[model samples]
Target: MITKDIQVNCSIVERFNSLDSSGRLAHAYLFVGPAYIGKTETALSIAKMFCCEEKPTAGQLFCGQCSSCKKADSSCHPDINFINSDFGEQIKIEQIRELLAQVRLRPFMAKKKIFIIKNVENITLEGSNALLKTLEEPVGDSLLILTTSVPEKNLDTIRSRCQIVRFLSETKQDLAEHIRTHYKEDEITSQYFAYFAEGCFGKARLLQEKKWFEKKNEIIDGFLFKGWNDDSIKKVLEDKEQVKEVLDVLLSCIRDCMLIKHGIGQNSLINVDRKEDLKGFADRFSFDELVAINGEIIKTCKLLSENLNLKIPISVIKEML
Candidate 1:
């Protein structure tokens, strides 16, 4: 789809149009935002607009019917390439080398060749330096779009060469509406999905598909009152991905509970799906206890992200409870 079709803040769209229209668009562009919040889609739209055969009418973006747009959107165009690791993973040295080798060649159909590198933060130290030369002296016809959840990891020099675009996500209500438009979810369940997504539409869709809110609430409730037992942890370990998602949602829940205890009001709770139970537990647990629990959850999540032993963290959390 074209850039105009995307539902994002107007400031971002306006900035892109201004740059592209004035012919001042930078060769290396950095998209700063959280994960699963449409960064990839926005980058793809930019690639399509750059590759469009005809300049689109004002306010209208790349025409999807055009050959260039179709090829780019479908990711079949030789000129439009996505540089990431195997299995849509990281930005590795090999991927960067292959991208560098490809960009040296001429465009297949479009006037310019575009590279969309997802998660620029994942670019290795070696890969970053390798891409540095390309970013320093662009072929004038080649464009690089780098998307990252955390832009701090990118080298300062690399960031200076690029035009940074910040993508703000929709509010809870907005995400809920998008969910309702695309799915058959009820109002309550849809709101829960939005709350769990933490204002990320793409994440909202995935959690909606998995009905993760249901699992999240169940897990939190079990942890508070019933507490986690061997059989319960065993069942959770059965699905590692869902277990990870559940832990993330659980951490958010504890954070909300902490806020509520500090008198932030019920509406401010991210765990709105079970505000009463969460508040009750928050009241039962002292402020220090709640804070410590939240810290452990966050620490555990961080360890998991680094590919640590999951059992050890879970065991620590169990003991803390």
Candidate 2:
């Protein structure tokens, strides 16, 4: 019932299949991993397996032809509930209360009531407490699945009640092949996307669709190459929402320069397309300087996320550069 024909985590799939075969699936599960690695999709697939009208066999996870599978694929299944933050805000206690109320009821059409909470790390303290109550006294024929990129941010009590499933990031080769297959891009371009994505498929796809590399090039040309100055830093920091992404790109560029300084192969560099420029830039800074700059960029990113004054970090980075 997973509509997206993308590659899933085989280990998790095998685990789910084994659980299905033995009928020993847990009441609560936590899918923890980096962003864009398809934790939500895996959760949905499990939901489909639970709700499918035609019982899936060992090999076949879900019978896509069934009515339940169809509904699940379209996210219209009555029993499958998805809870997420509203408008980039935290999931409130009221939302958790409503979910708890609904979970107490029996399934309308499916065999079980499945609740999938996305960005579980964003659950407020009160909401976490409300969810914890349900976790402690699990309802019959009910499944709770929580997905989070930042599992460390989740409350310990909530995390302890669920069966944790760790999802590792995809390999660059696998991600590149996925891009080549789905986006119809050539191997070189796909590899480029894969390198910059840092093992995140969703980020690779977004970069491809949005032409983010072009934007990255503009930033690099104006800020890094043209020279690190007040105007260039100001231009990069203008869009607070994009500051993290800009910093990531800058980090990649600096990483590439370090690689060049250490005489590493260009094939392993994230900024493969700009090897010459990176090489030239590498000469200007010592290896220690590159490492220090990378650290500074990371610190700036952390500061920006804390809602600190944007100019403060930018100024620090300017001085570092």
TM-score winner: 2
In Å, residue 80's CA in model 2 sits off its true spot by 0.4
Taking the tens digit of each residue's C-alpha lDDT, what string does model 1 give over 102-124? 88988878778889898887788
lDDT of 2 at 148: 88
| Candidate 2 global lDDT | 0.82
Residue 44 lDDT, candidate 2, scale 0-100: 84
Clashing residue pairs in candidate 1, if any?
A: none
Error of 2 at 85 (Å): 2.3
The global C-alpha lDDT for each of the candidates, from Candidate 1 onward, is: 0.76, 0.82
* Residue clash pairs of candidate 2: none
Off by over 4 Å in 2: 1-4, 55-58, 86-88, 226-233, 285-299, 310-321
Q: Quote each prediction's TM-score.
A: 0.79, 0.86
- Residue by residue across 16-91, what tens digits does model 2's lDDT show? 7688569998888999988877788788887887788886665666788899999988889999999965325789
